[model samples]
Target: MPTAAPLAPAATAAARAYLPALTGIRAVAAYMVCLHHFNPFAEGPGLGGFLHNLLLEFHVGVPVFFVLSGFLICLRYYGTEQWTGRWWGRYLRNRVARIYPMFLLLTTLTFAPAWLAHAPDTTRLWLLNVTFLRGFFDAHKYSGIPQGWTLTVEECFYLWAPVAFGLLRRRPRLLWLQPLGLLALGCALVLGLGPLAYEGLFGSFRFMLLYTFFGRAVEFYAGMQLALWYRRGLLRAPRGPRGLYTAAGLGLLLAAVLALVAVRGQYPYGQEAPAGIALNNVALPAGIVLLFAGLLTEATWLRALLASAPLQLLGRSSYVFYLIHFGTIKGWLRDYVTASPAGQFVLLNVLAIGLYYLVEQPLNRLLRAPSAAEPAN
Candidate 1:
């Protein structure tokens, strides 16, 4: 009935800045994962089980985050190539400043006391987590923050993204080659190291397909392609209706998730199976790219809601919340404050905000001070 709001400058500007609605989407993704882990819905064979299983598939949040990372990284740094030592230093410094400091602090805090008391075993696990090598081993991936496994996938992408962009610059049609090669490498690892059966090294096909960056690189590539089109000003909105793309994106995402729920037969979730893997690793990311493109170009109510001040703050602090949602901090919350799911969600968000301002922000600033605290790229 009324006119839609204008899009944010970050959405369409040539200058690279963070999009507010996308930041809000970060909040949604982190919270979806938290809910997936701490779901309170009743589990039964009928409608109740269906509802619970639907929530379980909220693991799709990880894909949303992956796609966002790819989009933002490419959007911000795609063509800003210097390729010199100083530029590489600055770029890596920025990425490290953004992620590593808080992750290191929290990860150490997670394992320190246990390491002190139980030096040998805990020390090795602590080393694995701190180095992020734990993510490569299925037996150890859940040792520390649990969700920290995603960081491994992220770091791999970070190291490889520039190379990918450079290759795409030369061989545009071979864009899919990067992810395909990664998939082949993963299969090799499974066939080679999997035979060893040594501590779940290289892991099962399910682990390789579902968890590793090699298999999940398609999601990032999807985001990268979206960024390329968007930066070229090709991601135009329709003349009248504002939310059609948003609605379609939501429909596609829901259809994928519901399909995953439907096919969970004989496995914990549908993604453990071959068909489920294709849907999650590919189809789900397609929905996310559409959703993000809509958010970037249109001024729908969804965009306005995501751009609101509170959601912005929540989105800013969402990384902290994602890290703390299920592990040690949640335990403390359950022990000290409230045992209820809803209550803990609220309390955890409050704490995450506090940590963002008090801890992550300060460390990020200090680390990036040598180079102005911006992205190295």
Candidate 2:
């Protein structure tokens, strides 16, 4: 084996011992997103609709992704000095490599079918989608697909990630500034900028972008805060009793979900009217923070579940699954959903896992692999 050039000895040791629990979180968040999307269109058996609506309210799964990114990136920067090489280039390369290929692949698949069905020619929105700028406006008012909105926010983070890391690298303590700044921006946008979205001049640009990224960035920052706390040993989780932490975490998770349901249920997805809209913004951020905190707590049961082989494996391949599963599963089931919702949900899960192993996992490995049997970072 070739020995790689090392960072500081202590830093290298820390890197080697990084936890897989975070990957498990990725899997959990991705499943929430999947269930949220599936519930709106498909019907299912016992507790399916209930679970769908409940999780739907807490769709901070997307927000959770942002927080996790911030947390991990900040953790890496704090751990070593290798954080400063043309940071933007490296950030762009890795993010693009991680996201764009699958997005483009799925976009093609989705657009083809929708267009064939004589769905409106969303050429303008489609162009914005490819460029990762759909969130800049309601450029998604009529797009290639529904979930495309989340990609817009993801792109915004990717664009800003390098600068974000650079700031954190310089003043790690200033990490809090990132979220505070974003929260302030979100508030300002909601109060002042959101109205512009309704007005003619600005159209939907300010509200759309602000609502999407401005509000969501804080969740990512919250994740970063969690990472910082863990690093400094200031956020040690409760570990003595399994039942206590498990119950506490479950309660927090449930509260967050119920809160979302109470708010969003009043306004449903396509209502086109704003009532308690601020609640949606505030609730999602709070829910994600609580959910992640619960997942990362010192509870034995939660830890065991997160550390489980299956959850960790699914989480490891989650990015790929997120990118491809929608197209793959929907395409495969285009013929079957008319049968029964329960059947569809079961088949979707089975097929998603299978495709994850066959297509997504392999492609991800090949892209990041060094050689056989060696894991890719």
Candidate 3:
């Protein structure tokens, strides 16, 4: 028989890399976020009461994504001059290109049902959602797609990133300082410092500029720190007892997820029900950031699993799925599936994947176009 055609060197080289594994991590995060949105298999509304807390406990995945984004931004930008440049216009342009189209699309999608039913607050909600001010005011807190709250946080970070990088420019090593300082200030406010100062400051619209924005900054900075560590070779690539690391990281994640679900059910909407525990806001995000860092750093089979192909696809498209799957993906599912938790999840995930391939991948091509200026430095 004729010898098989020799494998292309480039193809072989591509096969040996680890980026796909990182993509798989992205997939896991996206799935967790989807499950959280489904609100499924828990003890409350929507898809709750099916599984025994598996889905309910995994809501920490979003904060994990926040951390990952922070880390990846540092990885992509730390050495690049554009990120550390004089004007923020270019950075703003890139950020807008990445998020605005999908945001505008989702805002419009939220309006369709309202228009159909002539919902009274529809127009105002649309305006708030599109303008990135949805979470700043109490009136619009639960309006539009409920998931848009994270987008509001993301918008602030995008605006603040330049100021952040600028402040840390001279020291260079102190780059992590700015976001970390912001994070600590936020934690203090959430722990009631703001209330002590202004009597209702922490929970007010003005306070979002203080508390919510800073609280999530921790996740981002946690990621940035990891990126710095990895670059400095303080974080070696995984090559040890991968199985044990994977198992522990996953088990911790599961426990955190379950506890949050249990707490939510017992308390309903009152996050402070435990009185002194500070369960909802404090523990959950903290646990998520810790677990994610553990997973990203530790040597484990879990990391390898995260490096897989299918997971990577989900991970890369996470932003797209996040933006579209809420109303559009699930909204399309009404005709085909039973109105049960599992059915809704299956429908949403499938639609999310399709949207990723159809929309997200194509749009991300913009990030790859060569810049006219010298590549960031």
Number of the top TM-score candidate: 1
Candidate that beats the other on lDDT, 1 or 3, i.e. the better one: 1
Top model number, lDDT:
1
> What lDDT is obtained when candidate 3 is compared to the true structure?
0.58
| Model 3 alpha-carbon miss at residue 82, Å | 5.1
Question: Which model, 1 or 2, shows the larger TM-score?
Answer: 1
RMSD in order of candidates: 6.0, 5.8, 9.1
RMSD of 3: 9.1
CA error at residue 119 for candidate 2, angstroms: 7.2
Off by over 4 Å in 2: 1-18, 40-55, 77-87, 114-124, 139-142, 169-173, 183-211, 239-247, 264-266, 269-299, 320-332, 336-338, 365-377
Clashing pairs in 1: 90-376, 91-376, 368-373
| Local accuracy by lDDT, each model | 0.85, 0.58, 0.58
275-327: candidate 2 lDDT, tens digit per residue: 33443444445555555555556555666777788877677667656764355
Pairing residues by index, what is the TM-score of model 2?
Answer: 0.74
Give me the runs in candidate 3 sitting further than 4 Å from their true place.
1-18, 37-54, 79-87, 116-118, 171-211, 237-240, 243-248, 258-266, 269-299, 335-343, 366-377
For model 1, give the 10-residue run with minimal summed lDDT.
1-10
